[model samples]
Target: MELLRTKNLTKVYQQGKHTVNALTDCNIRIEQGEFVAIMGPSGSGKSTLLHLLGALDKPTDGNVWFDGKDMYSLPAEELARIRRQEIGQVFQDFQLIPIMSAYENIITPVLLDKQKPEKEYVEALAERLQIKDRLHHFPAELSGGQKQRVAIARALLMQPKLILADEPTGNLDKESAEEVLNLFIQAVKEAGSTLIMITHDAAIAERAGRVLRIDNGRVTG
Candidate 1:
């Protein structure tokens, strides 16, 4: 089934006197449980598109439909709720709380929702991601790969419908990158979640079931 759709999606930014068109008249559809990789060069509006799709920012023009609902048309509180409970995001920078242990970081979303953490599920997820041993370590104490794994676990903790990953392996070494990516793909597939990942590397893109290329803020494929 179609899980996400965008029509004439556009975003504009103003930097001083310059009007920057980050994205323009883009339309795309993503299906449930499909893995999609988006490729683009620097300043190509790849991240901008991801942010818009994930409901992190509002588009200047156009509409986004997630799960058959017009996301941009929803009220602010409803949109925020959908963003929190339905979409999961993983960043290249390993956006974990430095003060929290790896385990705490993984369960942060649940805590944010004011729900009790499901310890069994969290531990199983950590084990699957191979981060169970590192759970007690804080972000500062974990290696780059470990940190990213923790981030992935956090993203999957809520069993979100969509997972948005932005250059998730950019900070890791070749071996670690492959490891993390494999684990990530397996975890997402097992959860039957749709994945939209941004990757600059062609090799990485090839791993996805489908690839979408964006250039000058437009989706080329």
Candidate 2:
């Protein structure tokens, strides 16, 4: 089933007198439970598209549909609720709180919404990601791969309908990157969540069932 769709999506940025078209008339349909990879060079509007699709930003012209509801048409609080409950995001920088232990970071989202954490599931997820041993450790204390694993665990904890990954492996070494990717794929599958990832590596992109290429603010492939 189609979980998300965009129609005539466009984003334009104005810098003084110059107008930059970050994205133009882009249309995409993402179904539930599919792994999608978006590839593009730097400043190709790949991130722009991701942000719009994930509801992190609004499009200048067009509409976004999530499970048949017009996402952009919703009120601000409703959109924020969707972001917190329906979508999970993993960034290249790990984005874990340095002051919090791994365990605290993973459950932060749930706590934010005043919901009880599923302790068993969280523990199981941590084990699956091989971060069980590092729960008490802070982000600064863990290695790069461990930090990413923690981030993945956090994203999966919510069992979100969709997970958005932006350069998830950009900070890791070759071996660590591969390990993180493998863990991510398995975790998302176990959670029954859809994935849309942005990657510059062709090899990494190959792992996704569908590959969308973007350049000059348009889908090229």
Minimal lDDT window, size 10, model 1: 76-85
Model 1 stretches with alpha carbons more than 4 Å out: none
TM-score of each: 0.99, 0.98
Q: List the residue pairs that clash in candidate 1.
A: none
Cα deviation in Å at residue 203, candidate 1? 1.0
Among the numbered candidates, top lDDT falls to 1
Segments in model 2 whose C-alpha atoms lie over 4 Å from true places: none
TM-score of 2: 0.98
* lDDT for each candidate structure: 0.95, 0.93
Encode model 1's per-residue lDDT on 1-221: one tens digit a residue.
99999999999998999999999999999999999999988999999999999999989999999999999999999998888889999999999999999999999999988899989999999999999999999999999999999999999999999999999999999999999999999999999999999998899999999999999999998
Task: Compose the digit string of candidate 2's lDDT tens values, residues 1-221.
Answer: 99999899999988999999999989899999999999988999999999998899989999999988899999999999889998999999999999999999999989987899988888999999998988999999999999999999888888899999999999999999999999999999988899999998999999999999999999988
